[model samples]
Target chain A: MTLHIVSKSPYSSSALADCLRTCGNGDAIVLIEDGVYAAQTGSEKLQDFAGKAVFCLRADAEARGVAVTATVDEIDEARWVALCTEYRPIVSWFK
Target chain B: MKFTLVVYGAPHASEGAASALRFARALLEAGHSLYRVFFYGDGVHNGSALAAPPQDEQDLLGQWQRLQQAHNLDLVVCIAAAQRRGLLSESEASRLEKSAANLATGFTLAGLGQLAEAAAVCERVVTFGG
Candidate 1:
């Protein structure tokens, strides 16, 4: 499984949408940095990632004072590291 | 495991370059072979030989050069990206009629194909960006 990391905000960049378009089954998505913004409540982008293994970095969410919705799991740094190990070719999508 | 690192942020303006440098060091320490360090987008700025950071600050460009020298690392700057950012190799500068070249020592301007080749062979491809 490839760990696709998105670090750009959907509001400002198309990295998230582009990443989703190329991502396949069994692939995991980790939202970090400004990417956590996409997991916020009422975001239209969240719907596209439903049923996928989606995670957001808690530190980024808290730092931005964003309340992530239920669709995504909030992960700490340790979990992030674990995901890196569990996945291969961690791909980062940025603007 | 062999790895390829894609860096897409400027050295002085973002944490991406520094973070990538640290990660590269750790990978080498762990005995993993690095296939290449591909600089894309603003990451090409890391290859600017004209960078003159304060004496008190860590010289990131110099550190990268030293690392490349020690490991015989393949440091590649995307030629298209470098051209857009005014980072020219000696030949590119002459071809473009630029007065001087600013690509740092130990770095070569190459096509995106290098990145693809690295990805094809490396066990993992990690990216660092702003």
Candidate 2:
């Protein structure tokens, strides 16, 4: 499984959308930086990630004042590192 | 696991570079070997020797240099990207007839073939961008 890291905002870039187009089964997505905005409550962007593992960097979400939705797990830096170890061919979507 | 990181954001301009730095530190602490940190796009600016941010702001390039010194890290900046951004090494400056060199102490200018080799050998390849 691949770990797809999205660091751009859904509103500003096609990074998340582009990533989803190529994302396969059992892949996980981690939202970082402005990308955490997609995890905000009531965001329609979350629907695009349906049935896929999703996470948001806790520090990034808090710094951006975003209250991450219930479905997305908030992860610390250590967890991020662990995810890297778990995934093969980790990809970053930053546009 | 051995890993390679591709950085595409310049320090302070985007959070990606800072996040990459934190991740690099954590990976080391977790006993993972960093095969290389390849700087592409604006990431090449991280190797600029002339950056002088205010004292209040973080000296990100300096931090990278320190980490490189401490660990003997392989910080390679993409040659094509570095030249386009005017980030020249001493040899490059002389070759290109530029005014002076601005590449920092620890970073080396190389080609995309290095990235290809890294991806082929490293267990994992991650990217950080803004």
Candidate 3:
């Protein structure tokens, strides 16, 4: 499965939406930088990706003051690297 | 696993450089081998030798150089991108009749073929800066 990394904000860019559209059911999405805003609670931006895994860089979320919900796994940089090792065809969606 | 990093953000201006640096270190700490770091677009600014950030803030360019020294990291700045952004190496500066070269010590000005080759060979190509 591909690892889709989205680093743009859902509010400012379509990066997450575009990535989600191209993502397969087995693909995973990791939100970093401003993209971590999507993992926050009460955001309709991430209503998609029902079956796919979603993750947020914990440091970024905390830095941006985004309270990430349980729907997304808050991971550190090491786990993110581990994810890169476990996955293939890593795709980055940024504008 | 082998990995390549594609950095598209400028240092100090965008979070891409800092984010990519942290990720690079994490990748190395996890015992993964980094094949190359291809800096394209504004990310080429990370290779500027004259970037004098304040003593307080993070010195991203210096950090990248130190990382390169530690791991012999291949920091490839795109030729087209660097030229457009006025980031030239010593050879390119002299060849193009420029005044001085500002490309950092460890960063190499290369073509996009390096990125393509990295994508073909590396197990993963993680990108930063949007």
Lowest lDDT sum, 10 consecutive residues, model 1 chain B, at: B22-31
For candidate 2, list the clashing residue pairs, or say none: none
Model 1 global lDDT (CA atoms, 0 to 1): 0.89
* Residue-wise C-alpha lDDT for candidate 1, range B63-96, written one tens digit per residue: 9999999999999999999999999999999999
**Model 3 C-alpha lDDT per residue in residues A1-95, reported as the tens digit of each score:** 89999999989999988997799867889999999988898888767756779999999999989999888999999999998887787888887
Off by over 4 Å in 2: none
By TM-score, the best candidate is 3
Off by over 4 Å in 1: A6-85, A93-95
DockQ comparisons of all candidates to the true complex: 0.30, 0.82, 0.81
Q: Encode model 2's per-residue lDDT on A41-77: one tens digit a residue.
A: 9999989978999999999999989999999999998
Which structure is stronger by DockQ: 1 or 3?
3
Error of 2 at B31 (Å): 0.9
Instruction: Report RMSD (Å) for each prediction in the order shown.
Output: 4.3, 1.3, 1.2
